[model samples]
Target: MKNLFFSVVVMGLAACSSTPPAPDWQLEAKGSMDRAVAAYLEGNSRVEAAELARARAQLSRTGRADLLGTAELLNCATRVASLVFEPCAAFEALRPDATPAQLAYANYLRGQAQPQDIALLPAPQRALALSAGSGAADPLPRLVAAGVLLQTGQASPAVITQAIDTASAQGWRRPLLAWLGVQARRAELGGDAAEAARLRRRIAITQGSAADAPKVLP
Candidate 1:
């Protein structure tokens, strides 16, 4: 939401500036990146794919592989938030051109961030890099922290609740169901079959199905 407006404002401001205007591809890349994340979180995989391809094309116009890596990181972060622990392969492929800061951020998102990488993390993540928040932090950071903790097997109860609440409050179906699946697995592992069943039912409802949640365990 915010990035779309920020990109437009950048172009507007640049138009009046005496200096060189920002290139069209730069603004287009930002817009595509914003749309791609939004689409992915909303479960619009087709839209997500199209937007990513568009972003890559626009970004490639700059001849900056580092910027392309940044786009991949943003995409990877959303997946992590959705409980998808896949490696950020595209970003990894760009490592030869990535800046030190970008490399550190990639590790941070992967839950392998060292103490030195903490400073390079985004501001929201930095505050929660070492500890859980009140589960009431702003949306984006809170979920990123939850994802990191979950990836590290250190997710606190508050963090999990925050992730679910954040997704629910924002009406983001994909991450909402993903977090619900997490709760379901935890319930199952704790021998709470009833709770697990209940969580699965909720997930099914959100997914517009009458059946139980698809195997969310593990």
Candidate 2:
């Protein structure tokens, strides 16, 4: 759970048969995502506001354009999604791609796209989940992979449990918060309201602690 804004256009381009050159709007949008990322790194709030403005502008112009380039769009969508906490929009922006990884990530992201109670995913996404390997398999890669797993329901129970355990042991707050939310959502989907509520409470507790501390891991 480090905030990642993968370009929708990047995903689309990777998944599509023919690659498209980056459009001007997309370049601008990409710049926004970069700026936001940099700002997040520098702990500068103003830069995030600036990037959010630029991203929304790009999204407004590109949202309805038919045949928008996928990779660029996904990149843009991911940025926007993070800003607004809207993963559905991010996934919709990826509809043109058919790759298993992309599909699984899209689904996983969609599951927790919003901040509340969710349900079982469709079959295609489930199928996609079956094929997903542990993400890039490094810390950053694991997060990327974990995000995909969280999104697609491909994440092994042990992996999620281990993530929770590791976060507790290492005192990594944000990932723990995110994992807590994801687990709660999954529990709710599985018809375990009590379990989901427990996870939700953990999320609140972790978030409270995180608010007052410097993050060791996102």
TM-score, per-candidate, Cα-based = 0.85, 0.40
Q: For each candidate, how many residue pairs have backbone atoms clashing (under 3 Å)?
A: 0, 24
Regions more than 4 Å wrong, model 2:
1-27, 37-49, 58-105, 111-131, 135-141, 147-154, 161-173, 180-218
lDDT, residue 206, candidate 2: 64
For model 2, residues 1-218, the per-residue Cα lDDT tens digits are 23234422234322323367766776666567666644543334566668866865775585543223333334333332222235455446546644444444444544432212112322333333344533222232233335555555567876677556655654545455556666677788899989987887776666664334223211
lDDT of 2: 0.47
Residue-level lDDT of model 1, residues 122-142, one tens digit each, is 556667775555423456567
How many times do residue backbones clash in model 2? 24
Ten contiguous residues with the weakest lDDT in model 1: 5-14
Candidate 1: segments with Cα more than 4 A from true spot: 4-21, 133-137, 209-218
